[model samples]
Target: MTQPGSTPSRPRRGAGCLQSLLVLAVILGLGYGASKVFGDKDSSSSSASSSPSSASDGKGGSWEVGDCGGPDPENKPDGYRAFDCDDSGATFEALEIKSASILPNAIQCPAGTDLIIQVSRVFGSGDNKKGGGIPTNTVCGRNLTGEHPGDAGAGGGQLVKGDCITSTAKEVACASAGSDAFKVLDLVKEKEQCPAATTEPMELMMAMGRPYDVICGGKV
Candidate 1:
């Protein structure tokens, strides 16, 4: 008879080796499946982080340089809406768009343009409003066509620079001498040189940012 607790024979040792191999195979299979699941999760996270943000993406519906718009309503004081440049009601033309922190002065418009509109207001409703306390002023520009539109007898044509405009009892006068006639010059400011043809320097006030004296010559 065999002694109790003796070392196992070759066949039994072979059985133990088979069981160890099976256990290792199961561990490796489970590890591979877990790796596959975690790898997909990491890839998805990377894709989401790389996506673009909406507000600063420079997409459609955002104002850009050269976009033209006009004030909403017939004579709204506060806001504007985009319109085609050829639209009959269009008034303001955008020359540039910039952040509030870096906005340039209104008088410093690009060469060959003059400031026609300047706006600094908030946009949006309720909680979605942007630029609440922060103020941003943008200067809109237009070509300097000498003719002032809607004037009587202007005929929708350009006017000559330095021409006299008169508020007569009959029809208005252009470039004529009368008690009511006043000369038109490029918008002037106080302390600036008087017009070249000024015969007698007289102080005439026009409304702008503030009432300032523009020296006129040739008539009182």
Candidate 2:
């Protein structure tokens, strides 16, 4: 007997095959969609990082902001020098901790600055001249960058402000450090510090033993 409005099914084998095929198609579609989403995310991230950056200078050198580009004005309370070569005949005053007793190996700025640790040593030429050259470039196994490092500007070093210094505080400190001669005084800052150096308020000024000189002339 034929049932009204009813259709006959194909073989059971065929029905199972059809269902398996349908499941596989759905899986493939979902997989394709998910892959596209993830792929897009990666591409965007790469694009953002590769965008043109002015700081790169298009010449493969990273540009640092606020680089004063020359020596600090002389007579600064704290200034900079670029260590170039060691004469080993320099002289220095011993450094004493009369102003502050900082951490065992910490370099500090006056009030309102964080503490940093940068070390430099002075050398002596001794009366016999055996070891007096304090090459800031290689003073006590450390290189200093003053107006000259490795011959100053002749492939020795790229000096930044405060990279080397000769100051009352520094001179005093160096004198107190028990070094008989002065090498190059590097005014090292905390790595990645900004405004490499700044003029301190006159109130922070201590009496000067020597007058400061201008390393670079301003528009004055």
Top TM-score prediction, candidate number: 1
| lDDT of each residue in 7-67, candidate 2, tens digit only | 2121112111111110000000000011111122122110111111111011111111111
lDDT of 1 by residue, 1-220 (tens): 1111121111111111111110000000000010111122122110111111111111113334555554445223433445555565455345544333322211233222222233333334443322132233343333222333222223111112243443311112343356765554432344356666655343432322322233243442
RMSD of each: 35.8, 35.5
User: What's each prediction's TM-score?
Assistant: 0.36, 0.12
Looking at candidate 1, the ten consecutive residues that score lowest on lDDT are 22-31
Instruction: Please provide the root mean square deviation of candidate 2 (C-alpha atoms, Å).
Output: 35.5
Error of 1 at 7 (Å): 99
**Each candidate: how many clashes?**
0, 46
